[model samples]
Target: MMILRLALAAVISAYAAAQPASTSSSLVTYIFGDSLTEVGNNNYLQYSLARADFPYYGIDFSGGKTTGRFTNGRTIGDIISTKLGIPSPPPYLSLSQNDDAYLSGINYASGGAGILNETGIYFIQRLTFDDQINCFKKTKEVIRAKIGDRAASKHVNDAMYFIGLGSNDYVNNFLQPFMADGQQYTHDEFVELLSSTLHNQLTTIYKLGARKGLR
Candidate 1:
């Protein structure tokens, strides 16, 4: 975990440094992923072991209370937002649909989530990548309602999307002894499946107005 944190920090720093000096502050940021980039989405889920909303998880954060992050402090999303000069987008489940916050961005990451719905079936319930995109579609509606179609269209198109996925697809699905994905598909076939799924997902988001993106 410590090594992962260090590597993530280095990546964030380098990514931030590469951004243009005069980047627009109006640039929105939408985040999606699993435990690695999750904020607090799983805390709202029922019957899921993929929770981080407990002691020892936020020992290094301000207030010293868990914020449902999968680490001791701020997530990569949070730090990257700071580096980019934008407020961290709040967790999707933590915000009301009617809230004006959607104009900025939202985080729809869940701790046990993956590209495939069955990746975290052992957790009973989780928001898969498909589910997250569906939620983002709803967010888009709200943004349109608040800002009107033209402006909302530009906002979404100009916004940056950050998705960190696939880890749980290995940790909870491909590597699980009881899971059938491995038995049903060879490693190469599994990679192809994931590739096709991701390509379709990216295409869906593009049709919905997501342009500038990162993953």
Candidate 2:
């Protein structure tokens, strides 16, 4: 999968690469990825060990309050949103009961997640890339309910998408001796699998109404 930083450079010309439509106040962003793009998704995963809730994790953020970002400050996602002049979207789980944040978009990234479903199994409760996409789909349904179908469709089609994945598939799965992928496939085969899966994943988002592909 394409890292969020790489996606940033490719999708936008400058101003931190999350360029909102010139006619709109702010472009809604649908974020998907691993820790590098995760804001606070993992913190709400009850069984998740991939959380970044510790104080040191947000020592550099506003008021020094940890918001589940893995970094000591804002993440690539946060920076992108700031550049676009909007609040960073909140975690997907955090939206289950909140409707006021829909216009801000939703973040489905999870720490330790990867393109492959099994990539972060050791994290015990991380959302794989597939899981994140599913959450986005559910998010779309909620958006439709909030607004009429036509407006919701337009909203989704006009939104920006950011995806960052794959690092964990290399660091947490393919490189781990005990992982099934490492035991069953050669390096070349593993890469092919990743590419193939990601292609389908991207297609799904497009079919669901996203005009741009981030990964």
Candidate 3:
């Protein structure tokens, strides 16, 4: 875990440094991933074991208080948002359909979430990639209600999306000996499954008005 954190940190720093400066303001940014990018969505899950709402998780963040970020400091998504001069989008659970916060963006990442619904079953509860998309669908409805269809469509299309999924599907699912998926699939088969599922998910996002994003 420590090694992964260091490697990701280095990558974030490198990416931040490589980007040219821009005067354009940030658009709404949708974030997706596992614990690596989760802000506080898991905190809202009552029976979830993948929670990180206790001490030391957000020790290095503002006010030295836990914020359910799953790490002692800001996540990669947070770091990138900071570098981009944008407010890190809040957890999806922290907002409401009637809230004005949707205009900024939302983070639907969960601590044990993955591309597949069964990927983190051991964690008791975690949003899958499909679940996150459903949350976005609600967000779309809210935005559309607020600004009407045409403006909301433009808002969604213009927003930037960042996806950082897949890790949990391996570490918490297929790689676990007790899990059925490992026995059911050869590695090649598993890869194909993931690829196909990801393709469908991306297609859904496109149809939902996602014109640009990173995965």
Candidate 4:
């Protein structure tokens, strides 16, 4: 019986030793989209229309400080991070000081951002999808430099890429103008545009080595 117990202890030790060290480090999560994902960039935009800084915005979040997340509490990205075993990404604008921590994936989502280039109805600081993509590319480069090619590749390929958009394109471009100028595109035209834009964005991310993308 003693010999059997010793063998069991040996087996347990071997199994524990085989487990990888806990690195606290994890793959980077890149959240890209509109107000839904905008954690704080709007505060620097010099525009009040797209800002979400006030009571009741982050009422359900930790400390109840308005982090500029549009939702009443944690945004979808935050929920995804909790599921993926990593910290919620920081906003891109807040990374101006070259903090390597922010480079571990940043939120390029602007509050009034849209899929179309000319869709920011009344806001001058709104970002278009093209602009968001450009910022994403820049963030990728920074991640590559700081985390090395392999880690960066793993970070991107394995990381969760959350994209929440299209609603703004509909709100700011289609519905608003339809109400104002009575300008109407058939429903088909609107759907086609949205689909094509989404496809292009996903294709771009796939090319960037994104294997685990979400919408």
Over the stretch 22-64, how does candidate 4's per-residue lDDT look in tens digits?
6324556677788867888778777647887898899999888
Tell me the TM-score of each prediction against the true structure. 0.91, 0.91, 0.90, 0.78
**Order of models, best lDDT first:** 3, 1, 2, 4
Worst 10 residues of 4 by lDDT: 1-10
lDDT of 3 at 93: 91
Decreasing TM-score order of the candidates? 2, 1, 3, 4
**Model 1, TM vs. native:** 0.91
What does candidate 2's lDDT look like per residue over 1-215, in tens digits?
44546756445436444444673356678888899889888888898989999868999998898888999998888887777676788888887544768766888999999889998898899989999989888888888888879988998998988887788999999999999999999999999999999999999988889995455
For model 1, how does the per-residue alpha-carbon lDDT over 1-215 read when each residue is reduced to its tens digit?
Answer: 23545565577567677878678477688998888778888888878788998899988977899988999998888888888778888889888878888988899988888888899988887789999999999999999899899998998998888877887888899888899998899999998988899899989989999987664
Best by lDDT: 3
Best prediction by TM-score: 2
lDDT of 3 at 97: 74
Flag the better candidate by lDDT, 2 or 3. Answer: 3
The per-model lDDT (C-alpha) reads: 0.85, 0.83, 0.86, 0.71
The residue-by-residue lDDT of candidate 3 on 109-159, one tens digit each, is 998888888999989988889999999998999999999999999999988
lDDT of 2: 0.83
Better of 2 and 4 by lDDT: 2
Q: If candidate 1 were superposed on the true structure by all CA atoms, what would the RMSD be?
A: 2.8
